[model samples]
Each structure stands twice: as structure tokens, then as C-alpha cells.
Target: MNLWPTYRCAGIKVVHIADDWSSATVRLKLGPLNRTIFGTAFGGSLSAMTDPFFTLLALKQLGRGYIVWDKAAEIEFVSPGRGTLTSTMTLPPEEVARIRAATSTGEKFLKWYATSIVDAEGRPVAKVRRQIYVRRKRGSC
Candidate 1:
């Protein structure tokens, strides 16, 4: 599914998505619709920008034989976000291997990933942590 248009209309842009679904980069541009009363980036938008990447990446790596879902999330506002804010989510091959090994027996596994939203000048604006739940399907490899 194409989410770029929907997110971009809300001022969040999906700048890049890897062919292998191992990484993705998103940018949120400060605009009237996405600005808070103080004229900075809205907290909800910042959190929303980071909402799906981890789960999506995990699902891709684990394939259809596994169930992947966003279990929980937390965001810390480190500074007032301004200008174009960017965050990149990555799922390294090693991490993918770990998840597969852990859930190979059809047991559930929870994994956490962290990403930082940065301003155009590369200053950290927010820190986001996402926890994902994964389990191998009962009858699948």
C-alpha cells in the first residue's frame, strides 16, 4: 500500500524506503497544518511519523508465516522540532536473524527499536522507542 501521499498531505513525507524493506526514512516538514500553537512541530505528528516503520520492517523480514504487530511505543520530546525533521528506521540483518531464531519454535517474541527525529541542522528533536511483537504461525515454517 502507498502511504506516502496520505502522510505527505499531513506534512509527513516518506522520503525513502529500501527495496528490501530493511530501512526507511521519513521527513516531516513544519507547516501551518502541522505546527503547534507555539509554531513548532506538533507532538502528535512527531509520534505519528514514527508509528509504523518498525512493525512494517519486521513484518517484511519475518514474512507471512509470522504475525507482527506494534506492541507499544514511547516518545520523548527532546527539543522543539522545527523545519524539516527526519528519522530513519533500520532493521539490521543480524537483528532479523535473532528474531527468527527466537521465534522459530513458534513462541512469541518482543523486540524494541529506537530512532531519533532530527531537525534539518541535525539536532535531536525527539526520541522514539517502539516495541514489536512477533510470533511464527502455528502451521507455518
Candidate 2:
């Protein structure tokens, strides 16, 4: 995703996505393109760094029989972000199981996940919450 326009332009780089699709790490550099007037990380960039990760991880783990979408999101700024900031998203095995069981009967479900964007020293810069929508595809149950 480093080359994706939205991420590239905002100075966000996807550092790692686990082989099993259970976790992903993203980084955002506080550069001119993504720096606020206050000389901190731009709020939009901080938020963008977290978007799409949870949904992507869920979809990959759920397979073709399931449909997953990013239903909603919110970000709370905790402090000024300087230098490079990192965020990691993880979908636990139990949570994946829960999602599968919930939609096994062809029911739709909504789940919320949280992550934090932190600076190089591990100070939180923002807290993000993402709501994911999931369901079994018709005839795929």
C-alpha cells in the first residue's frame, strides 16, 4: 500500500502485514505533505493511517464466502505527533471465530475494533475505532 495514491500522498506506508492476515503495521511520516500548521502530524494523515487495515484483515481471513466492509470510524487525537508514527491492527483468533459463528447462519453482524497511533517513543498520538460490517454471501453458508 506504500504506492497507493492515498497513502503515498499522505506519507503513510504500510510496513508489514502478517502472513496469516491477523495483523498489520502502518507508518506515517510527519513530512511537509502530512504536517499540520502547528508542525505536528496532520490530523487527517493520522486518521488515514488507521483506516482500511481492520476491514482488510477481516476480509482476507474470512475468505470469499464472506463480505466485509468498513462501516464507520472515529479518531481521537491524544497528543501532537512528531517524527514517524506507527499503528498496528490485529484481529485475534477468537474474534475471527466469533465473526464466523455469528454469520454462519447467514446473518449480518457489526463489530468494532480499536487501535492507537503512537510516536517513535510509543506515546499515543491518536486513538481510532473502526466498525466493520460482515455477512455470509448468499448461498455460501
The lDDT leader among the candidates is 2
Per residue, candidate 2 scores C-alpha lDDT tens digits across 23-117 of 99999988999987889999889889988999899989889999999999999999999999999999977789999999999999998899999
C-alpha positional error of residue 134 in candidate 2 after TM-score superposition, expressed in Å:
0.2
Look at candidate 2 and tell me the lDDT of residue 123.
94
Candidate 1 ranges beyond 4 A from true positions: 1-6
**Native-to-model Cα distance after best TM-score fit, residue 6 in candidate 2, in Å:** 0.5
Off by over 4 Å in 2: none
Give per-residue lDDT, candidate 2, residue 11. 95
Query: What CA RMSD would candidate 1 show?
Result: 1.4
Q: Best candidate, TM-score-wise? A: 2
For candidate 1, what is the lDDT?
0.90
